[model samples]
Target: MTLDPQRLLRDLFDTAIAAAHPRQVLADQLPADRSGRAIVIGAGKAAAAMAQAIEEAWEGELSGLVVTRYGHGADCTRIEVVEAAHPVPDDAGERVARRVLELVSNLEESDRVIFLLSGGGSSLLALPAEGISLSDKQAINKALLRSGAHIGEMNCVRKHLSAIKGGRLAKACWPATVYTYAISDVPGDQATVIASGPTVADPTTSAQALEILARYGIEIPENVRAWLNDPRSETVKPGDPCLSRSHFQLIARPQQSLDAAAHRVRAAGLTPLILGDLEGEAREVAKVHAGIARQIALHGQPIEPPCVILSGGETTVTVRGNGRGGRNAEFLLGLTEALNGLPGVYALAGDTDGIDGSEDNAGALMTPDSLERAAACGVSAAERLADNDGYGFFAALDDLIVTGPTRTNVNDFRAILVLERHTDDH
Candidate 1:
């Protein structure tokens, strides 16, 4: 049987996504019956779907609100689904986040609040802290995206700047039992980093947020800086009474998704080497993958040929140019350049949620001849990479993978298929 590397790689991505779908993993994680009201609140790319999952599985009276990216809403009867901007907060998210805080406030001890947290939740639940405006928060978020800051660093700052994040939401729930079911996106699945840890105790400090901003050279507005410096803006810490009653569970994570993909690869009679949910700048991560692929092809050191290298985790791209593409595209572009059309090697990098950066495509694919084909089409891979135009480069080759919102996110899914090295001997 002829092996279609592209198909295999894509299949692995699908397996990874399917493993994290809310319907598949959430129902089992829900809490049992509570005497008081059951209120569900959440924000993220997967918020709406998770709310729907709870509505389907729990046969109790439940009502609440959840904010998801504009196009990623799922049908829920009791819980209200609010569409909002992501990767950056908007007024819509602010409005809904306020309502979420109000709903859980002054609740009784018997009341239960199920918070469906996921990636993008930090922006989705955008409630600026006192003295900070939405515009201020937006500006800082945009700067962080372009500043090449990692998710942890960005969230560390976001937690300090927000009113509802960094365990404040759980604090608002007060005496109510807060049950947080999160779909992990950040590396290591740190509960506090996922959506800024709306329901979990935040160990990150305001001083740390200030240091991250300084380290990234991100200029902060006067008021925002003052708020970060204020001791009152600190998040709920471990052993805090507000979060004492809250129980957090990571229902889905990047490593689990990678394992699912690896299972599929093994079923295909191919050895799978998981790179362990790598995290770094996109271009740097791509170079690392390329180095590994080259090693396997040239020396067969890590593993023999006819193997699939799998990795998962989020990677950030510092936009140097007004380019159109997400981090996945940037990674592929870098990988393509490094691979230089090495024979019998193909790869795919995509976000599990089906969107890469702010673009419509999930990600893109690269074959051994990607560079040669791009040149034929009058497209320069290196130039595109310089301009951070991965989407443009791949679009020109009709290689962009366009899967409209998968409604689930486990960060990035990357797979490189390395086949047997070919030798020319006639």
Candidate 2:
């Protein structure tokens, strides 16, 4: 059967998104009704949908606020959904952060807080620590993004610089039972790292956060510096009593999305293989992907023709030049180069949130002839890689995938589709 590559790719993308949709998956996980007054709070691309899910599923007196990235808010009744900036914190984020903290502070022992945490929450819940301002945190966050630090490292600094993160929000709901439902966007699904672990115990220290800042050459304001120097400014540590009544539950994750995509691939008359979820360094990951594709093309050791290899996880990019790129773009450019016009191999890599490293494109698509097409358009794959402008290269070819506000983030989704070649073009 002849395969329509575009339609197949679109179907796979839809599958990934469907696997992580809060509206479809969140309701079943929440408690039917809490023993006390229930308040719903959340942050991330999926925050609004998560709120809607709670309102529809939980039969209780629910009241609270949820903050999501701009353009990701969903329609809801009891839960107040607020739109704010992401990747970088803004005034709207700061305002909501303060308000959420305030809401938690007045909770009584008979009350319960239902926290819906997800990716991008760290930036959305941006209440600067006592002496720090939102602008200060924003600057530091920007620097961290360009510094090649992984999400975990960046969030560590964020937790220390915020008044609402690092379990501080949970601390405020001291007398209340805080129940957290999270969508894991970080590698390993570390509870403490997801959304800066607003309701989980922090194993990091102010000194550690300060060290990360120092490594990135980020200058902290005098007040922030003083706070870091003082041991009393520490975030909630392991065994902190303030978190004694809290519970964290992971509702969705990258592996589940990858598995779902693989299932669809098999159902479409192809063998499905998962290439593992955890990965690092976009270029390196691309090289590994290319090697696997090459093996399938030549020896067919791992699998035969008509197969799809899937993977999910966050990858890092070391920014050495000024380029309109992101980790997803970098991976695509590298994959395109390695394929070198090989026949019948197509691949797609994208951030599940529909945004690739703050760029307009979710990710880029690479066909077997991607390099040739790029060359014909006067776009050199090697040069684009050097400039760190993969996004620009793909944009010029109109190969960038644009999905506005998916309202969910599960890190990156990668798929390589191999079809039987009628002719030996290799």
RMSD of each: 1.6, 1.8
Give the per-residue lDDT digits (tens) of candidate 2, residues 307-338. Answer: 88888888888888788977999998998987
Q: Candidate 1: deviation at residue 126, Å?
A: 0.2
Most accurate candidate by TM-score: 1
Q: lDDT score, residue 341, model 2?
A: 76
What residue runs in model 2 are displaced by over 4 Å at the alpha carbon? 34-36, 421-426
TM-score of 2: 0.96
Report the C-alpha lDDT of model 1 over 258-280, residue by residue, as the tens digit.
Answer: 89999999899999999888778
| TM-scores for the candidates | 0.98, 0.96
Report every candidate's CA lDDT.
0.91, 0.86
Question: Candidate 1 versus the native: TM-score?
Answer: 0.98
lDDT of 1: 0.91
lDDT of 1 at 76: 88
